[model samples]
Structures are given as structure tokens and as C-alpha cells.
Target: MYYADAAADNSVTAYDLSSGSRTVLCNMHVQELTLYQEKLYFTCTDGEKRTIYRMNLDGSDLESLASCEDLWYMTIYKDVIYYVNYENDQYAILSMKLDGTESRILRKYNASDLCIAEDKIFFAERDTRYLYSMNLDGSDVQQLNSTYSRCINYMNGQLYYYGSEENGRNVYSCDLNGNVTGKYTSGAKFLMLMEEELYYYDWDDVLHILPLNKKSEEENTSHGTNIVSYKQEDVLKPVRSYLASNWAGYTLDEGNITKQGNTWIILLSESGGSRQYQLIIDLTTGKITILCTTEDILPVSVYLYDTAPSVSPSAAQLSEEELNSIADTWYEQNYGPGGAWCFEYHDYDGNGTYEAFAVCGPVMGDGYDIDPYNILEAILYISSTGEITVIEKDVRDTDFCVENEIEKEYYIEYDGKGYYVPHFRSGGILWQPMYGVKDNKPYDTGISGHISLDNDGDLLYTPNSGIFMCPECNNHVEHKHILAYDETSGELKSAVKYPSGEIVN
Candidate 1:
């Protein structure tokens, strides 16, 4: 079996279950080490990027899969790697091919404890008392039960998890239909799921295991997918020290800083998504300083099929001036002024055509200052054929874009289909899955507080944590209080948190 050994140099270790011999597969600070189809997929830092890498079990032909802003839990379902990609001010569950093609964001909210159960991916919901399930394409999400699972897995038609209650810790088992089957060991912390054994830890942190029935191809199973507070804890030291400077009286902690050759690039945020900025730091001088703003900043996937067609111009043909001119116009027209922007040319949609994706938004303010409503974050797409399409979003009507409900969507069917948008309507919350999601399921109140897709016709919604303003009052508000969800009811609970940890609704 393959697992991770992060005690020292951080390696992927393989252990012979029978012979009990150990072998080191790779030496990189790895997270979410997954073995699929004889290839091991894992994530590590390359100084400038948090990249996912793929290699053989025998440790040869190591290749890069994709580079994301951040990734926590990862699992392989049907040869595709579904991972939690952390963004500047938010987190999303994204899926891509094993080699990093066909990338899509499934959810804007947080995901936790990802695994597969009964042909669907199962995971534990953080800060909640339920286990959830979803399809591989990021649809059909539903709450399994009220069990406050700490870690979980599925095996032999049984959903197994280690959960904690007011009394103590307990291991529980249930069927695919959410019926309690039996109760396993108690007062134990579930570590992971094996083919026929359950690994656990006691109160003293001693590891132990108990045997169970075997499941076919158990290596494909993911256990205990968890998402932490999401700081760039693994960033290089120089980058961290630079960020520690607190540029512009703003805090740069919890942001991404990577070293690319002599240049240091940073994607930073103050409070997750409230104040996000991209900076290119130059280390050529004796002291580090700001070099430029606009280069590639948005995290994107690079696939084998991303090669351009014959009609596409050569790398030398597209001058930097020409590209920046196009990007500058788009940013000023669609987004706003006084912001940082970065663009990258790639087949981000995996449609075999290269597109220049321009990510631009305003600079964030320090905690004391409130932001203006003029700041609208926009991701514009300019295809090689000169076709421009903006990623559709259901955001507030910051500008004239919200003149009509239809226009409020702010998207065209041509391209950049942003799926699973949680629209908080006057009646209730409804999720708009425009395309690329499973259509078989229904949505309703029964599946409330969950991100699953169903056909119940209920208003499915998720918290919209964006630059929000009180439309009637026309005042800027704290981003944290802008979008807070009641973890139990799944309703748009009106609440806000101040910097002093005070709660107001």
C-alpha cells in the first residue's frame, strides 16, 4: 500500500502489507497522496507554486499535473482527481483529469473529508453534524446524516466513520441509504480506512487498528478529507519574510508566496476574499522590492491537449505590449480601475483552443477602512480567435449590470459557464446549475444545509461571499458578515463577524 511519510524530508512511502517492508517512493513535502491506475498523484511545493505531480508507483517518470492556488484533500474518482483548490479569499472543490485537463470548480464553499461511497464521493462537513455525498462532476450533493463525523470512508456497501459526540468518540457504520447498520469500536479517533482494518488513535495518541471485510480495489478509496483554516503554511521562507513586512499597511499573512527563478510572486489576501492582490516581487536587488503587477496570477491547469492549433500564432508573435493592451482594455471596461491584474494564455477550458484569462480586481483595504462598491472582481476570457467572454456570475448589481434579473446573471451562453451558483432570492435560496452537472437529481428542503443536487425543485443556495453592499442603504459592510450560512439549516442566515471576533446580525 502507498502512503505519506512526512516526519522529516516528506516522502511517499510504500509498505508491503504482507512482508512489512518499507520503501520511499518520492521525497517532496507531499499532501493528498493518491494512487490510481498504477500512477501516484500527490501535491508539493516548487517554491513558486503549489503543484500537483504524477508518477509511477515504482517512482519513475514523475510529471506535473496542475498548479492550483492551494489544495487540501484530493481523491481519484474514475481516473479524475477531485481536489479542494484554495483561492485568494475562498475555497472551491475542483475536478480535473489525472494529467490536469478539463478543470472545473464544483463548489464555492469549503469541502471536507472527501472519499467515495457507493459510486459517489462522500465526505465530512466541517463545523457540522453531517456527512455529505456528491457525484464526480460536483453535482448531486446531499447530507448523509446528523453524524458529526471527524473522519470517514466507505467499504463493502457500508459507510464507516469515526465521529465525536458530547460523551466521547465512537465508530459507526451505516448503509448507503443512511440507515444505522451497527456501531463499531468506541472512544477511538479514526485515522484511516484500510482494506480490512480500521486505523485509529486513543486518547494518548497511540495508533491501533481493527480488521474488517475486504473491499475490491480499496486503494482507490479516500478517507477523512479535511480542510483546515487554509493558510499558506508551506510557503518558502524568503517569501514568508517578505509577506511578514505587511505591505501598504495591509497584512499579507495567509497568502500564497512562491519563488520563480529570481522573482517572487505573491497572491495575497487580508481576510480570505475581502482584500485580494497579486504582486511580483523582485529579488535581483540586495533588498526585495515590488517589480510589476500584471503577469500570470490566476491559478490554472496545464494539460497535454493544451497545445494550440496551426492558426495560433507562435510564442514570439504575440508581443507583450499587444497582449497587455488587450488585457488592460478588458479590465478597465468590465472590471474597474485602480486594481491589480494578471493574465495567462492557456487552454484553461480544455477545449483545445488557447484563451487568455485576465483576472483583475481592486486592492483590499486594511481592517479599519471600508471598501468602495466600485470594486468588482472579474475574470475575462479572450480566445486566440479574438473572441471575448466573461465568466457568468450571479453577483450584486455593482454597476449597470444588474438593471434586469436576466442581466443580473452577467453571462452569455457562448463560454465561461460558471456552474452551481447559489442565488438568494426573495422567496428562498436556489442553486443555478446552468450546465455540466448531473441532471438526474432533484433539489428540495430535505437536502437543506447540503451542497448536493437533487430534482426536488427547492431553492438550493450557498453563501455568496463577495463584495456585497446594502442595496437599499448603499453602505459598505464587513465581508465576513456579508455571507454567513447557518451550518445546520442551510438558510441564508443574516449574521456578521467583526475583526474582534464579535458577532452581529
Candidate 2:
């Protein structure tokens, strides 16, 4: 037997009739509660979120079973607790084990007033305004009766319910097979059967006791005193802790931290090497698994540094066709005709010789350049089986003119080997230069240059400040403020803001 009390002092308590003792189930702001197997289950609404808790009959072992931003009604059956989750924008029936494991949605919509019968479940749905029943496994579904009800219970060979439709609220009893026997006079909102007495709460906020068979006035009053009393303000605190310890790590590079089930899995790259280590921590058992040292593992060097490598987004997995397409496009953009002549030191040929290819074509431009042409460069790889590689080359102009001088030239120079060059042309004139070995290697030292372009197609030499352009309008605008472009039919817009509190468009 169970009852809820919210005294004038705002304390809430739930009483167990067998022990004739009351326990403070939830100390917080609880709006609803139910009892099963001597454990008190209740819903507490804290701010915008609601959490369901379960505790021992003595209010000792309290634990939060499930939580969500919006949870309405709850009922317990077997080893699972089912509740109505309202935040999903649909009526969803969710269930979780008594141990707070495997919480998942049971069904969606067509759900109201849920009750667990002997091996069967009953509920009222809005669409049909009928009472329905189904096996505990959610199969063999069938409608029991047509009515608008909120609370339902199945005891012995009878079904008891209370609901409101056009005529306020009333209590009704029916057989297990959906045959309504009669309606009781009491206007009860919830009903329960205990010791052959119909225990229910009336609309007057007072508890009522009705016998299965008509009883005398004295018997009715005597049965009412047997119902345990409790104060609603008595809050119950659970026995278990909720928060987890903070995670500590040396670096975040190549690190993967994820939660699986009740365990946290962490895969981290070892310091100063490509090797990685794995750690698994179980929250329930308080166990940790660490792979520190293992056989058949090679020892790598490590170094301490003030700064660590910044991790970029992991590369997406691509199929063979996708990889081939991407490689072909990249090759064309970097080595095709009118493209940049940059050489990538990959094993393009099966030959053991790590040869160099002077690619001449139009490649994709990286820096600020509108329709930028391709440049040239040399390539070298560490070995056929090695991962590291190098690129080297130099760029030189055909003419010795001052303006033609390659100033601000960007060349892909190796940290160890050669350098590459950039190729630019105009008209039918050809400006190809001959290569020769000098100083034990190929080198260039005439009119080599670099160039930087602004966001606009205009060229800029030694610009004092970094310029940022609006991505949408392509306008060289300030940072943060919106700018409208008169060109492009007023379709162009940019954001520009000065270091001061001024905005310009």
C-alpha cells in the first residue's frame, strides 16, 4: 500500500502499510510517486529538467534511475520502470531496468493511463478514446473498452479505473474481460485495491476507503484509520552518488575519448611516437584497464615540450572509387597542363628509383589568386616503403626586367633537399628554362621571386597589415560588421568591423 503526503510545510513522504512506517522518498521538488516491491519511485522536477528516483523501503538506498528535460507519469513492473517522456514532442513510453541499465523507448503515441496487469498491460489512448490491453511483450494487442480514463489497476479477476470525460470524474469497476459492472459514487482520481478494500483518493484532496461489499459506517471509518499517513514535504535522498571524476590527460592530440555503456574508453597516442595506448574505465564496477607495456612492442623516443601538436579533424573514410577520383583530380590540379608544376614524392612508378617529375600544368591555387596559374617544383621520397618524403626546386623568370623579377615567390623547399619553381605566361611566348646540375645538385639563382595577392584580384607587395575579406561578398571589409555590395544586384553582403567600436560596409 502507498500514499502521498505534501503537508502544509511543503514536506513530502510516502508510507508503506506493511511496515506501518513512512519514509522520506524525495527531499526535492517531487510532483508524483509510485511504490513497487517495498521501493519508492518518484519523479522530481528540478528547474527545467525532471529525474526519476528509486529508493529502498526504508529510504536508505536511493538512486536516480532516469532523467530527461521532460518526464510526466511513471509506473513500475517486474524489474523495469516505465515512464512517459514528454520532451520528445510525442507520447513516448520509455522503460529502464531497476538497476538503471538499458533505458530505451518502448512505444510511441497512442499512450495514456498505463497499468500493469497480471501478464498483461492496459492503457487508454487519445485517438480512439478506448481502453486497450496487450501482452507484457507488447504483442497480442486488443482494445478492452471505450472510455476516457487516467488511472487503471487489475486485481484478482476485476479491473478498477477512474477517469473523467463529459461528467466530471468517477470510479468504475469492471471484470478482467472488459465488462463494466457499475460506477461507484465517489469522484476519485486514482484507485488501488488493498485487503479487499477499494483505496482511492477523492477530488476533495481527502482519502477514501470503500469495501468490496457494502459496509457499515463504523467499518468504513475503521478501515480509513488503517491507511498510513505521511507528510508530503518529507524529501527523500538516494544512497548512490551521481557525478563522475574529472578526466585528466597530458595532451589531446590523436586522442579519442568516448563513452560506451557504463564504461569510458580512451585511446591516446604515446608521447614522441606513432604508437597508441588504450584505457577503459567502468563506472559501475569502479575498474580501470590500462595497456602500459606489452610484448612485441618497440620502445620509441619521447620528449617534453611546452606546446603540443594541434589535432585537426580526422580524415573521412573513402572508398576505392572515391580515392581514385580524388587522387586523379589532385594530380591534374598539381601536375596537369597550365597547372602548378609541383612534384609530390610518392611511388608513382613501381621502379625502385625515387625519380623526380617536373610537372607542367594549371593546378589549383592556394593563396589569394583569382584564376591563379600552376607553379613548378621537384619531388623526392624517403624510400619505397618509407612514409616521409621531401620536395625541392626553384623558380626563375625568363626576362631580367625589374618588374619581371620573381619577388615574394612561394617555393616548396625541402627541410633537407631541393626547391621548386612557379610558372607564369602570357601570349604565345614560351618561358621554359633548362635544368643543369650545379654545386653537386640542381640550383637556380636568377630573378627568383615570390608574390602575394590580396582578397581582390589586385596584387599587393609587402602589405603592412593582414587583410580579411568577407566570404559571401568577396569584399575587403572589416571584421564583424555587415556590408552590402552595390555590385551583383545587391546580392553581395560582407561583415566588417574595425578594431575600435566602429562598423563599416
Candidate 3:
């Protein structure tokens, strides 16, 4: 049997059950682990990237299986190691041979907690709130049932799982065909099977054991599982100075966790009155290093946020200037002024062959009515040669009028030839109506209400209000209280409102 020790150093320890001898199989500060074929597999951090590694049962001949910055967990079958790679906010299940060959992605899901049985794999998906199964190669992937389950154990052609229900925690038993038998136990927190008895750690930290026989009464099978005893004093240790320092009034944020070299770094923020400071902790040595301090003079809010530092590639790394130069040349020739030069390149094209989009503006001329302030115009350029073309003029409107009436209008001249115009829509007045609303509007509803809308142009605001919209449908919506209409169909398809001081659609 194989077990992972995630609580300490994230290592996998294997034992020879026949001889009662054990060895540390694989050790690393990885988040997930598993074993197969007298070999240990786990995830590890190499600088800023997370990757997978495999080693023999005796912890020798370690080798890398896959290189992904987000790989997690592992389950080995006959000759394959199946794992998950989370990147771009998506999770993909992948498998590779023992020698790191023939890698294939089994399936993709927003998932957590995974296990394998026979030729099938099981996973818990939070979005669907269901335990799903799929063939080892990704075919036949489907949700087994509507049951919310976790901590799956597959043995003897039976699947044992646990989950929380309305009343309390419950253990369930099912077969390979997704058929539920019955509840194994209720009100149990941590349940595991060893030998023939079910071992569990209770809510009170007391261990209990019960026989696996389904025929016995529930109360008759349970007994204490903890065989070792110790005095209360023996289990407690005096808190050291450095350990106690962690309890100081310091707040930790998500970006504070980072990996460097072979250690994890965590940044803690300490606040005092109107001042704030930051301390960095090295996980390997348990040492703290102060980074910076924000005094009362500097706005505390500006420096209060935590951000993970980017890891820079080695200076010897080759630069991609050649590729960039080629792309720039093509961009200027195909989209420059007097041509199609009104756009700027934003991203590579769908086929990954060329730039997808470019930024372009209009050309300008001298001040005149036809020239409308004679401002310079700009356009996006694209070609094999890098060159920019511009039309120069003045287009500023300091004293402006609206609809032949004296009204406030903001206009500015750019590059001694371009003009900027402003309008009012919602967010804020912009230079043009095509830019929609500005972003200076208040976002909260003073009455602390909720907003709802439907397709029939019906609107509802609520604290305890009922459904005010008949059958409302929204095509696109933004921060509550904003609405828009479809120009082509003349139909209202967007609306926003606040509910309970929160923005909702």
C-alpha cells in the first residue's frame, strides 16, 4: 500500500508491508502526490514554474515527466501517470507513459479532488456540483449522478466516498456502474479503511475504529482507533519567539504567496495607526525580512496591496527582436496612413501567423469649417517596412455650443493637429458618443436594493420586492443602472441596477 504525507514536506513514503520496513520515496514541497508500480510521482516547484517528477520506490532515478507551470496531483496505473494541468483558469487532465512518452490529455474540467479506478477516472467539479467519470483516454466523460461527493477511494470494485448533506457528514458506497448501495456511516468527519476496520478521526480529535461488516449495528462496530497514548503536556510545546511573531497584527493576501529557488515566500502586511509595513517570510528557514514601510506621509492605501513579483528570465536568454522587427515592418506597410493605417496591432492572428489587429486614426489638415478645426488625422499602418504617416491640422474647440445652444463642451487639440470631443452618456462624458459612457458615476444604490430586469423592458428594484419583470432577457449588461438598445433591431437588450447595495443583473 502507498500513502502520501502532505502535512509535512509534501513527501510520499512507501513501505514494504511484508517486511514492515519503510523508506522516504519522494520528497518535495508539492501540493499533490500519488504512487504506482513501485514508483513515486509528485508535483514540485522549479523556480516560478510547477512541474511533475517521477522516481522509483526507493527514491532513485528521479526524472521529469512534464513541464507546466500549473501541474498538480498524480495517479499512476499500469504504465501511465495521470495528472491535472491548470492554466488560463482552466483544468485539463493529462496522462503520460512511465518514461514520459506518449503524453495525452484525457479531459478538461473545472475540477478538484481526483481519483482513478480500473480504466475510469473520477473527479469533483465545483461548477456542476457533481462527481464525474471518464475513460482513461478522455472518451465517455459524463457526470455519474447528482450526488455531491469528495475524498473518493476505489478498492475491491467498490467506490467509497464522503460528502456533507443537510443533516451531517455521510459516507456512501457505490459500484463501478454508478449504482448507490447505501450509507456506510453518518456524522463521521475523517473515515478510512485499514485492515478490516474503518478508522476515523472524530470532530473532537478522538480516533475511532469500526468493523466494515454491513450487517452489524452501527453503534456496535465503533471503538477508539488511537492505539498510542500521551500525557497532555507531552503533546504541547512552548511557543517560540519566531513562531509567536506570526500572530502579530499582520494581514496576508493572495499574491503574498510565491516560490523562489527551493523555498516559498510569503509577505505579511503590518498596520499601525496610519502607517503600514511589509515583512517577507522564507519558508525554508522560517526567517523574516522586512521589505518596506509606508509612513503617515505616504498614502497607506497606495502601498497596502500585495503583488507577486515577476521572475525574470536569465540575462543570457536570446531576445526575440528579429521576430518583432519582422512583425513591425509588416504592420507598418499594410496599415499605414494613406492606406489602412488606422489601427494598432493588438494580438497575433488566429492562425498565429501575423498580427490580429492594429490601432489606426484619421489624418488632419489646416483649420477650416470643412476641416472642422483643421486637426491632424492618424491611421493604423501595416506593411513589410516600418513607417508612420500623419495628416496635421488644428481641431480644438474651447468655446463650444450644444444643439445651437450655449452649453458646456470639452475639447482638446493633440499633436498640434488633432482634436478631442466629449459627450455625455452614462459612465462619463467622452470625446465622442461612440465611446459610450464615462467611468465617474456612483456605483452604489443609496437605498441598499437589488435590481432585476427582463426581455419585455420590465425593471425591478428590491429590498423585499417581488419579480417586477415578466420574462426579462438581457443581451449585455454593465454595472447596475445602465441600459442600452440594439441599434440594428431597435430593441432594448441591456440594463443594470443595484440590489442590496450590490450590483446585479
Candidate 4:
């Protein structure tokens, strides 16, 4: 198998699992890796410029395809190369033919984890840190879910990606429209699915394999509460020792240990029970990484609620004008002059120190949709000492829409509780992707399930446009028939009617 090692200077390497041998194909800063026909396509740093290169499997006939100042990721579909260009401090999703012809920009936004499947393009927008799907031509953009997702992989009619939640980064199975169906093992980075097994890297950068031939019912038993083998102890000892020495009062929570083949997922909490952390350990290397940390208790029931809790404003040391001045100065320094920006202060987590949402644009407007040509948004955290931490940037928030009253809710869960995260929106007219906050960092929490109808009573599904049902084979078809999405199967069916007017799925 051929893979790009992002940690190893993005070196493209080929591994022989059966023979336990390895060979380095390209020794450069290879960023993106994909295979088309018999050619290996990848992007690498090439002396004063980043360029895309293609070569044979044996590393022969190397040729440069495209060059730019900076490129993030790329994917190929139907003999075309789709990549993100971060030149001139702007992210432009562009596509070109195999011979590097017909190059054009598809969208002006920051994108990563780009993958094309089922004739649709899936990507993770860095600004909001959410998964989104769009047409192959980069139109009909739709947010799939709220999870901060990357390392997207598609298999068996389902899309799987690494979801960054309050708990940890785990692999989640969702439909094309982003309705989460099931969660697999935890703590994953790059995921590569094979015919009989799934190979992925753990948080420790160690490689692990999961059997794909296992039955669905056996999945839980395979990874849940199994007795710790002697091999598992070796992995835990290092993590336990690391925590005991480095974390002082923090101790490993043995009860939460989950076995995912060669990897182990463990939890730890402070002696005073004030903070808890989730970690994954590599069995072979005995390496460990803290996936997430929370105060008091884990947010177990956060997903049950939909509405955001209200926050009562408190007296602030900095006036509104002072906050605006700070935000304006930040905008000018980061994006330069001749740009319009706006700011709003709110204690999102009900903390005494208020954070500001600064939305900037190239046009002289105050709202998020000021310029269709440029995207600018930032969530700035203001500490009690007047320190600023830009938690998120390049986000297009809908809450700041000036034309319409858009009520979008963002949330963060802590200590078994959920708090609504704040964001601006422009009603139902513009993109209203939700955002979630955890550990003072904001992430995109994508929209799901809801379906809207057009003025002609035609059902409009966001993720899949061809999804539909028939009240009767050829009988009266109307928009009243609500479409029910099956996340597990990634199929859309009518909630009220069947394919032939029968009351069956």
C-alpha cells in the first residue's frame, strides 16, 4: 500500500504488510496523495514553490502537473484533479484535467480532507471545521454534520471521517447528507480502508489494523470491555506512568479502557475530580496522546438537547467601544487596511470574560454576506487580563446576517451539560452552518435531518438531490410526502408513502 507520511516530511512511502517491508517512493515534503489509473499523484514543496507531481508506481517518469505558492490537499475524479490553492492568503478550490488543462477555481474557501465519491465532492472547511458536500463542479454546497471532521474515507455506500467532538477524535459513519449513523474505534488520524481490513493511524502516529470482515453485531463485542490482554498492559503502563509523572494528580481511569485491536483508548481524571482527559495509547510503540480534556465530568447528555441555554450579561471591565477597538486593530493587522469588519461581545459560556465575534469582509459592509468574493470571520476570546486568543478564523457565520432574523444555535458540552455556542446567521437564505465550542476552541457542527421545500412544493434534499419517493407508481406525487433518511444505510425513503403507495419502508 502507498501512503503519504505527513509527519515524516510528507514522504510518500509504500508498505508491504505481508512481507513486513517498506520502501520510500518520494523523499520530499509530500502533502497530498492519491492514485489515478496507474499513476501516483501528490503535491510537494519544490524549491521556492509547491507543485503537484505525478509518477509511476515504481517512482519513474516523474513529471510536474501544476505549481503554486501553497496547496493544501487534492483528489482526483474522472480524470480531473481537484485541489485547494492557498496562494495570496486565500483558499481557492480549483480543478483541472489530468494534463493540467482547463484549470479554474471552483470556490473561494479554505478546504481540507478533500475526497470525491458517489459523483459528489466532500471536504472539511477549515474555517468552521465541519464536513461539507458539494456537486462535482463545486456547486450546491451542503454542510453534512457538526463534528470537526477530516481524513474522510468512503466505503460501502457510507462516508466515514475522523470526527473531533468534546470527547475525542473518533471515526464516525454518516450518510451523504451528514446524519451520523454509528461510531467505530476512537483516536484516528489517516484512515485507509482495504478489502478485508481497515488500516488507520492512532493519535500516537502508530499504525493499526481493524478487521472489516467482522460482522456488524460483533463490532461492539470486538472493541468493548474485552479483557485486557498481556499485550494491552504494555501499552497502558507507559500512559499511566506518563500521566502520573507529568500530570501530578491525574491518574488513569482503568474502567474506561477500550481495546481497538493494537490500540487502547483510556481515560484519566484529576485527583480532585475537577478535570478529566481522554487518551489513546499505541500498543507497539507504547506512545500516548490526550484526545480531549474536560472539567468536572464528561458531557454525556449534551447531544439530547437542541436549544441553547441563555446567558445573563454581567458588568464588564472593558467597555463595548474598547472591545471594538481591539477587534478592529486585530482585523487591520491580520488582513490589512481597506477592509470593513464588525464585532459583537458575548459571554458564550457564561464566563465573566466575554469573547468577541469579529466578522470582516473586503466590501464596506457589516454582515457576513458582505462580499461573495471573500470570506472573513473570527471568534476572539478575551481573557480577564485583556489577552486575545483567536479561537477560530475564516468562518462565514450566519448569525451576523443583517437582512434577516436568523436564529442559529451553537453548543458545547461540559460536565455532563451542554451550553449553546453563539454564531451569526442570515435566516434560511444563506449558509447557516452551526458551530460548537469546547476547551475554548470553536468547531463547525454541521446541519442534519431537516429538509426544505421549494415554492413549487418540490422536495429539496441538500446532500443528495436525486433522493425521492413515490406515493404511487404513477399516482399523484406531491411534496407533502416527507422523506425519511436512513443514516445506517445512507438511503432516503418516504416517511408516509412507499415506492408503490404501500405503508412499508
* Regions more than 4 Å wrong, model 1: 6-8, 14-23, 47-49, 214-505
Q: What is the lDDT of residue 385 in candidate 4?
A: 22
Candidate 4, 187-271: lDDT as tens digits: 6778877774556776667665554454672343223212122234434444455556567877777877786544567787778
| CA displacement after TM-score superposition, residue 297 of candidate 4 (Å) | 45
Model 2 regions more than 4 Å off: 1-4, 8-26, 201-203, 213-505
Q: How many backbone clashes does candidate 1 have?
A: 22
Q: In candidate 4, residue 123 scores what lDDT?
A: 87
| lDDT winner | 4
- What lDDT score goes with residue 277 in model 3? 48
Best by TM-score: 4
Can you rank all candidates by TM-score, best first? 4, 1, 3, 2
The lDDT values for all models are 0.51, 0.47, 0.45, 0.59
Candidate 3 similarity to native, TM-score = 0.39
Work out the TM-score per prediction: 0.40, 0.38, 0.39, 0.45
Q: Return the lDDT, model 2, position 68.
A: 86
Q: Which stretches of candidate 3 lie over 4 Å from their true place?
A: 1-8, 11-27, 30-33, 165-167, 187-210, 213-505
Residue 302 Cα positional deviation in candidate 2, in Å, after optimal superposition: 85
Best of the two (2, 3) by TM-score: 3
